[model samples]
Target chain A: MIIEGKQRIWADYQKEIADDHYFYVRSCIRQNFFPASEVTFWKIIRDYVHKDIFENEHHSSCSGIGYHSDVVPFTTTQAVVARQFALMTENGYKNLTSSCITSFGVYSEVLETWKNFPEELERTRDILYKATKREFEVPENVAHTSDLIFKYRNQINDMAKYRLVNVKTGEPLNGVEHIGCHYAKMFPSKGVGGAEHPYVLAGMIESWGGRVVDYPERRACCGFGFRQYFVQANRGYSVACTKRKFESMEPYKPDFILTNCPGCPYFLDRWQYVIAEMEGKTYGENGYGIPVLTYEELAGLVLGIDPWDLGLQMHQVSVEPLLDKMGISYDPVKKYLGVDNKNIGQPTCPSVLKV
Target chain B: MGKLYDMLKKDVRYQEALKACINCGTCSAICPAASFYCYDPLEIMEIVQSQNETQLEELLKSDKIWYCGECLSCSTRCPRGNTPGLLIMALRKLSQDTGLFVESEKGRQQLALKRAIGDNIVRTGYCIYIDTMKPERHPESGPVYEWIYNNRDEVMKRMGANYKGDGPGPMRNIPQETLDEIKKIFDLSGGTELFENIEKYSEQKAKEMGLQFDETTDCEYFNEIFTKTTKKHTL
Candidate 1:
């Protein structure tokens, strides 16, 4: 289940889970495009949630992004993931959670398949063991942030201290939840529900007393098939898929769409406007044109967390309507996001030195 | 072969830059243009590395090559610093330089359109400009021309230029040095003759194939000439 907002989930998860030693997996796109979200999510989990997450210098990228481009070979991807897993094992972190859908999916595949494919696993283990002299075993459970959030849902709901009053027409708010493909599609048998009608994120939203709306293209990929956008002009199909999702949700007139993965929010929010312009349609009338926000941001607001503190302004589209819906007043000048912004900071990577 | 490999090796910056990729397929999955087209960035890198001439040839011949919208979303999100979009552009340059897939029908048509558009731009610094109010005098021969006519203002806005109605007017504004440079490059690339022949051949093929031939019209003439040229030249 997907619970909207940061405070409730963070507070509850902190109280319930004794195992905070997380194996944080890095995402390629998030590192480059949306670094702020990555930094923010980790900071909240570490400081506010008081989770003992561990990130080490020895860990490298999972290489799943390059695999689709056929740039990197499968063996090479296996080697990279194996190296990361070995590092995690050395650090005594048994559970791995990734912010990126691709990293989560690729790593999960490698870990889950290792048990059945001993020969392949042996090859990867031999290479890393010979190189670093470190032995590794695939964890029993590999999860995305959504999994952790779902596991600790009841505590999240109990910790909710504030309510959002939709200032837009003085009514309560409704939301549409976006279930990321990587999280939902990684393991079909684990039964997180089918990728198309994933109840993980939607269930969390409902638990928060927010209604979840299902759109026609609810299962459509967020057109972020990585290198496909850059090399070709076929964005029309991806945009159309996103447009279908918006059209399906339009009937509900949702206050905002909430997502767990950063990439989905970027594509769904920005591409919604682009498709509207291409088809000569305005956003609110024929299209829901609702602003997209991360589940953390939504939850933070309902718990009376400051919008700026939640990094709400980092979004491409204006979050004023969302804030208005949540009955929160924000000063545009005071909340301006810039280099000096308090909410913005370097990632937890050792390469980033705190000023 | 050594020289070519050396050249590629020296430009190993592109390869090393891309080493950081995590293989998330995010670039391919999010690519808008890749959704409908057969072009795959990952495949391009594989072919580039393999130096497979046949694969390169096949890639250049496909219509998917021309379908890129030049959006930089892939580069923006690519975990590795590689820009597959830019890599495709480099391959396009290679295709034109080597003449590997120039005989394809779409290739020839594109060549013709490029020449016609280039020449029109050179001569007038603007595409075909006729008063929209005088529709009787300016007749469109095809659906393409009709669309251009209907969306002239929109097209102009998109291109970010204005058309002046003065005689022998806008062409003079472009620098003579720039025009000479363009011509020199066109000659060096053998594009001028290729474009001319394309137009000539298309018209002939249109008639020979029993296709509607509107030679009286400039657009139709150009289309037929290019089609015929492509048909005549297999390799």
Candidate 2:
């Protein structure tokens, strides 16, 4: 229950807006796990926000997980990140928006490390020049896509059709916002609200009219420690961390969990499924499981996008309860429509705890 | 004439990651990895600070360092601003570089990880490809994904994804020029060298264990290491 670090006021955490043109580097894991969220993010930026976001085929993984896992050396990671910046320079993008929080953290860390040690930066620059026969300029601004959304939350709110309240009950949806650890912890000053009181996800929730739940472990890691999750033996640690968050927040009786991190939403949703299987337990007010959504998914919902279109069916812990609460309508039997409407079948049966 | 601890102190991450070790135990108390596994960040720091060659070498050969998820939760809470997560990173690097990683079960999986994630990057710009997440390998993706894969073209069209067809869209084919550029960077950036190191060290370990150690990602040794699970550090 102990709050850590020097807490910053909301005013201290204002992020500078990136230039209208952004070179986006998508997270490899995000695309595989929840492609819909990424799609929705691009759609909102282009269609709703009217921003110029660019994704060239040249962008690659930040090598963050690989670097952290010790397979890739620090030099290799530094050079790889430099290549990304080179791509940005080649594409004439002054703003860099990374899709994955981990990639964002890696970028931040590389920048920070380079700041402290210019020699490493020179080495990376030289290696990159030799690697691609290309020269480079660093982006003027670096922001996670979540940061962009958080920075423009009020604008998004202005266009939102549905509030974060239940339509039938006319009550605010109680929400718990989980910030990705890397989003702030790596460098507190760079995050939305600093490390002690990050408000990236919270800002989105509040902007969308949800009642934010402040729990003891609000800042706890989603526990997708790269190697921890990759190695099955270490997954207990990953699950234990998620369990701690769930246990800490159970008292709040929140309706849903929302996160900005690619790993957080998946782990939060999947761990609930794991906990249910391991110990016949459910925690949300409805007693099935709390529906976990990324910030983009929440935005898509507020924009009146159909529930199934957000790929809620791909989620292990059902979002049906939340969808029902929101009164978002779609055919239940027809929800499992896969690519090109081949009618991909659904899970044979629904959970007993289904609302 | 310098010890391994001395070498670590020379590393920038170690220098920046460790400010001053006050032994507050805050790092360990809040560590998620420590809570589930027989691991302690503060204790690891204590061992490292002791600068004993035997303990440091033992650490390199042990499975303990592999338990840290590198979440850097310790980095945020450390009163002295010493990040055990970053310290773990330093230790893991030293472990792998010295071929000591092959001694531990988790360390042995480095080859599997290289094949899965590292090689995936070279093949596709992604560390994981949608096509690779087969139900057999990742049943956790659930049955919904199985049906979705069987009818991806239809599902992707409905969901608004390009689904590997082409043109600027999510999940579409990454331009070939980009793939070539990525491949060249990997070769120039020591990534290929690191990959080879992983293969060589793992092969040595596999040979010592009397297991087949083919250079290819496939084969008995790679499969077992990838699939095998351990409870050695479980609480």
Candidate 3:
């Protein structure tokens, strides 16, 4: 529990993250759940940070879900990811950044697998060539999109219109930063601040004027276990995982939960509503569950992006309370409206949780 | 070494994941699955280390092998650098390979995964498409998700996504050519074969269990595996 000891280890895990021109890949689930988060990322990087980021419409899902769920073979995952590297090589980019933490882990695993087993790497090359007639040189750098955001946190803060602070109280808001296990747990050296005390999200929390909540379950997974959630009956395990984290963090009274993983934020956000419905429990103040946000959405808010435009409305648990706490304004009427400004209709509220 | 051990030894994940086990409970202590389910990664490792064919075979056929969330939390804290999570991956693969996965309730769900995620990849180029995420299948997502599913086009348009349309953006309709390429990669890389194995074994198990099997998702066997749970899964 030595703070200085953790700091030293965190410093040791710092990677030489690239600053520009990364070939990007999208998550299969992230876009479906938080559609605008990636769009918000483009706006922040290309529009705000003034950096070069490229994506291929041809590149598809990294097959991490299939691979981890044990349907896709490791060789298949390697070849599929090799095709991604081929797309990058053809498009002439050397850096790779994926929006999903699972894809980040897949990439890290593939890279490590290749380094240890050149025959598998050769087989992957042959498979990619035979299938797509494409040749690939592995990217010079690999990073999660959040790592890129963390690298430019100071620049984002430099242009901040709002911060993670209670404007009324003038005290920094407490945020629980949860890292995806795949981000570093499997391969510690691949991540920003390693596995145990990851600083990727924590760095953003600190730089954006928020205090990090060191809850007992801070390092615990958000429990969007692919098969666990994908299969209906096993959902209890998934919800229970979220419940454990929420119970552990409740005593801290954190203002919000922040995450880098596609699944983490989705589960952390949606499960609160589910938990309240099932058990009549709520983690946040006064029947409102704690607001969970992706790193991009948090950045979008700090950059004065409209709450509705950032797609905070997609989240099951409402972000309104946290927005209000930060003194960020939004037209509550516009929350459920379409681009045509017509009411799209609202979801039925849960019994115990506010939406 | 026995048959099961021989097969496990061939898997790169098995080779990389299990180095040495001192029967340390660190992996089990850190495992989220272990906390909820009656699972012990330390015991799983110890059994694997014993090289006993009967124990390993029993493990492959049991619900215990399927309990891991694959979070790889067990991969991080092993004093011997033994990644029990990766070992679980290897054991699960062997389970599927030998048609033993259908013996347990959780293991039979492999067919559901093969159809949902595995088929989705070959068909849609994305492992999950919005059209497939029906609220009935995913009740945990709740009423908001149902609304979003119903009004997805407008919602996606507002979010600036292409929403199954062409060109680069989230949830955009992946091109047919790209889908073909992905299918080909799977074909050459043993994914299609693995998928076939899951189907072949699942269908066989369904017949043995006297459940209806069909090509589509709506079948007695799919329903059973997708919905079946035992109280033993939880504390």
Candidate 4:
């Protein structure tokens, strides 16, 4: 691969992510999949960086999943997205940032579609007015939550208690950075480093002292193909896609996988256990699976946040092994404790993955 | 040019996706679904470009259109800038609208998606509700999901989520009025019609196939589409 050519392409695809004051939207599945990652993004942006990121309680999903699944019509999806813009306009926020990569792609695609088809935009406006009586003005800028975190990675690293390095070895940990296909594949310029080599997650890894592993399948999908996984019978295709990625990256022996998308982390993390169960083969060292983490959890970790607080314990592939390698301290007794300090109970251990 | 081509040409997705087909096989080579399944975007695009109603009808009624993962990787690599993924979306919608989707094993799975993601959006205002994510139903969520599913309230609360509580934050309770607006939007924007057609056609197919049909997900037809997989799908 030509490094200079990739660098030239990356330079061309840099988008203008907003500096501050944004409207935040939640992912439909991210909260359920990685609840704390979204919460951590809010914490780091509001509590840590002191930015004005506003969210509306009444604002619902953008209907991207349903739209992509081919069940919801394009007109309905656009109208639902218009309602979100209406919420943002009503609340007086211009810049929009979403927690889910699919939602990010939806926002980008809708904006592009409106730019291309003025009649469709007008139709959507009428549909929103007829249904919700809401009028919307599109935001000035749209960005994924990772862009915001990447924008402030240096600031976060300044306050970090630990870097992305093994304390004992004094060597930087290798992080396999996976980009969600929708983040830029639909429109390359919508992402920080374009579709082929997205720097949104890589920038954060580099800023936090980690080596980005460019595996053969670095640009491959994590296989959260909405319907592919949603339907029970079609899961072989989903799992096989993920298995192809895991196999490609296994030779690199990366310490962990870093992901910006909500579904990427969940699938990359859980599918390891699934692959192990199906094939009796583990990807990590010594029968352990590679720990997959979202960008928010990684940022929270380096910033001296508790692993449990970042919802690390909720993962199928345990983060404890990585924590040990990083020399981060945590009390194992509190792993499954509730906010009330009661035991929330542990899951029955799988025979394959050593979680 | 035939009636099927005329109908396909009306869709915005068809207009946007089909610029021209040089048939370089770039899309099929880059497609993830093509890697594991007996699917080829280039072949599908060629069939659409041919505008043969016989071939187009066969393509629509077969599992071909349904095999797309919708990752749109094909959209990125097409030398002609023709998005076969979007074309598949247009075809899938056509298949569903014409009641031809239930003819194929995979096309019939649209009923499952309509029930799962479609109904979830109308009811909860989210595509995948936290409450509906049961471990028994979604075992691929991994073994640890049982713990998370059981202690969801406490776990979510601990993680600073609203966790079914009212007001703003992740997984917060979407107001009933908001859900009503969503349902109305779907009703006005052809979503409800699309959903109804799925059920209508699926029930007809169920009757023809000697499977029991019902309004709920517990019926035999839903089970058949939800769990049935043929060896033909794999490479």
Candidate 5:
């Protein structure tokens, strides 16, 4: 739903042709906390995918996090949507792609409701147009990166040339894929499959030669949005959800866990460590712990990209066990410094190229 | 008219709190926490609704009760709008009051942290404070001299006397009276003894179970021990 970073990569690979024009909506959380992930995603798209894809930076966050928490007013949300739509039109990239699931869910809901109710849209449009000297119509094309990635699964699979061999346990590395809540629940029809059992990310993992483990809390939220961990420490609720996933996947003894959304990774990575502490437990056959990884990072590893090049070590949870499981020697400092110039084996465009 | 049930009825803001179920199994069907273990939210809700103290006591004593992750998916998707998540919290509070499940090493350890937080909050309007922020040799390891030496500023900050101390403020608002009340409650709930016996009891139990106990106060080592132990138990 929120089409940021890894989701965008999935979309580009799925769509095959790089999208030149994009309504590059921003997220407050990502902008402040994970600016690099956002910037890197766009750079990858611009450098490797179609350079013609429209990129606009005028949109603000959807304010869904605040809105859902009952902190922000509904009027504020409507205003945000109105302004975002206007920005999309102004940038000549009416097609919108959300990097954050919450933003995608909010934008889609607002646009869908607006299209069905002219009076509501007109009232909001009047306020926005008067303020910005521009008008907007909810564009026909609006989707999360997941939608685009799922559409071109075969192409991505074909392009993936390398295979990651697990050095530990003498077995190939397996993963548990976490498709974020917004991507699945916000638009059921547009989703890859049943929202409860979405398999887009899992399918991709399988194609990439990794096994996808079915976890009990596979579909549950990572509890990041609730801020349950910080607000209500040691309540057992936040970690319980995480524990369910760990236990469910424990049977398979996954080498690493993959998630598309950054928020999920943040919570899963950090909270898994906390849960282990609270419960007084270790994971894996040899007390190895599970590492939360982004889909791109996992793909990069499988593609033989250096760990630091993929930013694998930046995660709060240690990826040492995962690297050991995959039998890859990782140098955190070097991996962090190395950049993927080839951008997942996609072609880079020269400045002379036209959109 | 137990305090737990009364609190749930009066304080829980969700609309589903009012819905009465006929011992239906639907909530359990979708409960993620229930999927792995034997605990069932529907069953827990039934016990609470019944107001049967015996059933409630039996439910509270089991390790299954602590498995809830509080995802609220059950609350959101319940056909009858019953929130097992809230019910579980109420049950945990009751369990703490009864001292039924506090004997377990993990439970005792939690009580220790809770007491530490409570005592520190009462004393300085904050949680635990040390001379430095660096990991020290755990108390069992005899006064982590190296950690104390290396991280004096961090320890001072944690002590609540420093400018950057994570003591109570405008937001966390841990008043002295509240801290005293919490400490009193902890004593009544046998939390003091639980906290005292954690390291001793956990080491013995972990050894019995063929687990290692590295009781280093070095925050990092304790963290590693805690994680390793919990992962083994959970998996």
Candidate 6:
């Protein structure tokens, strides 16, 4: 009965879930920092969920960064979103899924703004019309890709090739689920379990047989606030926020950090390196850092994709330790292999700070 | 040009982000910025709600307003459903729009951000491009990144990304038609004008500071703003 109620709640939580077809929008940071993660996301939607996804090169950014950075106003942002919607309408896909949490939040706020002031929609319409003679119908179901992943966690678990356990020890790997704040924090109800106990990443962690370790700073922001991190003067607040989260979570000694948002994974991973440089501080056992992966990359790893193929080498904190625990084998030299399938010699000895 | 209070009343962001404060201090308590910097979102809200034009305008010119990470964490826990993060957004928008953003150290970084992100948006259809993600700018990306910078195509290709390829996928070549459309949207939606105003005011500030100002991203003022770190928080 409890199981039934749980499924029922999930059912209601994702009532408007896209029907295996989506008009996909990309995240700029995701492609930059973790290119293969987005590629892996597409593979998951295709191979695991068997969803029909349409990705267009024409789908420009949601301009959420510009708007939040204060260089762009609401009118410009709304029009950009409307332009995206018009493209989706042109493509005939009604269910829209954004890869970035900020874009998802921006779209949600724009939807609210349109609902509150109908004239704003008309204003966007005029601009879009002037630019592309484009008319748009608002997507019936606006969802984050993470939300979709959360909805299908059970189905994904059934099809998993490997569980999140130490293959050598048969112990469940300890993991922390860092849900991006924008996923549900701004409007709690939009998220799977709302803000306080957002299940978007947690559900994925559990489904993959990883023990979801809870820490005091679980709900804190990843601190990649567009301006906060971008401006050197304001970066302390960003670094401090990330440091606070790392300090609180370090005691748990999780094997890896898993996140849903684009910037969260990047900032959380990058700042771990920055904190080491700035303070001679390091987390995890033996001065090795925590390997942070997106939920998609984690899923891809468990699904037995090649580690290097997922751009794990691009990660500052190596994933080899986690891979060894999982007994996943790969030719180490391939970490430097070119498209010609030849080793390109060792990468410049990683210029890590010596504390 | 208009009374700032009247303008605040008209902005939907101000209307949506604010509510009856009840002065509980929850927004400040939850604010990540408050933990590190001297920011207090509750105080910012109290000042905004009090509707003192001088103070509000002062906020527009202050480094304090740029402190919000826009994480929206405060909005989640606020008992009154008020979003101080969104309020900060409204404040930032007002600051940039009124040309008062040039007054603060943090706000001066707007020109750098505009070149780095805003111009990148127009040129690449994304906020950042891989070629421009420099080793100088991104020391955190470290030496592996430098090596990858030397061998980006090879590494990216092995990773199954379509870096500057013909068709649509990760890192594919965004067609000129799409870029043209994006430019038209910016021109039509006032983003272009906003960019102009940012440059116009920033140039004035640069001249005032006796710093070199130019159309390119490598001006002396730009380099100074981009690379300088504060000793205040280094401890």
Considering only chain B, report the TM-score of each candidate against the true chain B: 0.54, 0.91, 0.97, 0.97, 0.49, 0.94
Best by lDDT: 3
Tell me the spans in candidate 6 whose CA falls farther than 4 Å from its real position: A1-15, A350-355, B229-235
Q: What is the C-alpha RMSD of each candidate to the true structure, in Å?
A: 18.2, 3.2, 1.9, 1.9, 15.5, 2.5
The residue-by-residue lDDT of candidate 5 on B45-143, one tens digit each, is: 777778765666666666656655544456546666566664554455445544554433234333333333333432433222332212332221112
lDDT of 1 by residue, A1-355 (tens): 5576655544432312235677876554443334445555565566555677766643434555543332333444566677667767878888777766767766755665565566668777665555445677676556676666655555566666444445455555677777666664434433244443466677667776676766665655565544333222224445665776777777777777878775678677656556544564535432335777776666666555667666554444457766666667678764443334433222121111110
Which structure is stronger by lDDT: 1 or 5?
A: 1
Candidate-wise lDDT, in order? 0.51, 0.80, 0.91, 0.90, 0.51, 0.82
Give the per-residue lDDT of model 4 (tens digit) for B104-202: 999899999999889999898889986777787778888788888887888889888898889998899999999999999999999999999999999
Per-residue CA lDDT of model 2 for B89-123, tens digit only, reads 88888887778899988888888778777887777
lDDT of 4 by residue, A21-88 (tens): 99999998788878899989999999988899999998898899999999999889999999999999
Badly placed stretches (over 4 Å) of model 5 are A1-20, A31-36, A151-161, A164-172, A225-235, A303-305, A324-329, A332-355, B1-235
DockQ of 1: 0.03
Error of 5 at A176 (Å): 0.5
Per-prediction TM-score, chain A only? 0.81, 0.94, 0.97, 0.97, 0.78, 0.93
| Cα lDDT tens digits for candidate 3, B41-147 | 88899899889999999999999998899999888888888899899999999999999998998999999999989999999888888898888887778788998
Candidate 2 runs further than 4 Å off: A1-11, A285-287, A350-355, B1-3, B215-218, B229-231
Compared with the true structure, what per-residue lDDT tens digits does model 2 show for residues A62-97? Answer: 887788767777888888888889888888887999
Clashes of each: 57, 9, 0, 0, 44, 0
Q: Candidate 4: which docking quality band? A: high
Misplaced by over 4 Å in model 4 are A1-11
**Candidate 1 to truth, TM:** 0.55
DockQ of each: 0.03, 0.61, 0.86, 0.86, 0.03, 0.69
Q: What digit string (tens of lDDT, one per residue) describes model 6 on residues B1-235?
A: 2388787777788888898788899888888888887778888988898888888899889878877888888888889888888888878777777899989878778888888888877888887778887777777665667777778887778778889887777777778888888889889887898899889999999899899989887888888777675435322
What does candidate 3 score in Cα RMSD to the true structure? 1.9
In the predicted model 6, the residue pairs found to clash are: none
For candidate 6, the per-residue lDDT at A23 reads 93
True contacts kept of 6: 0.73
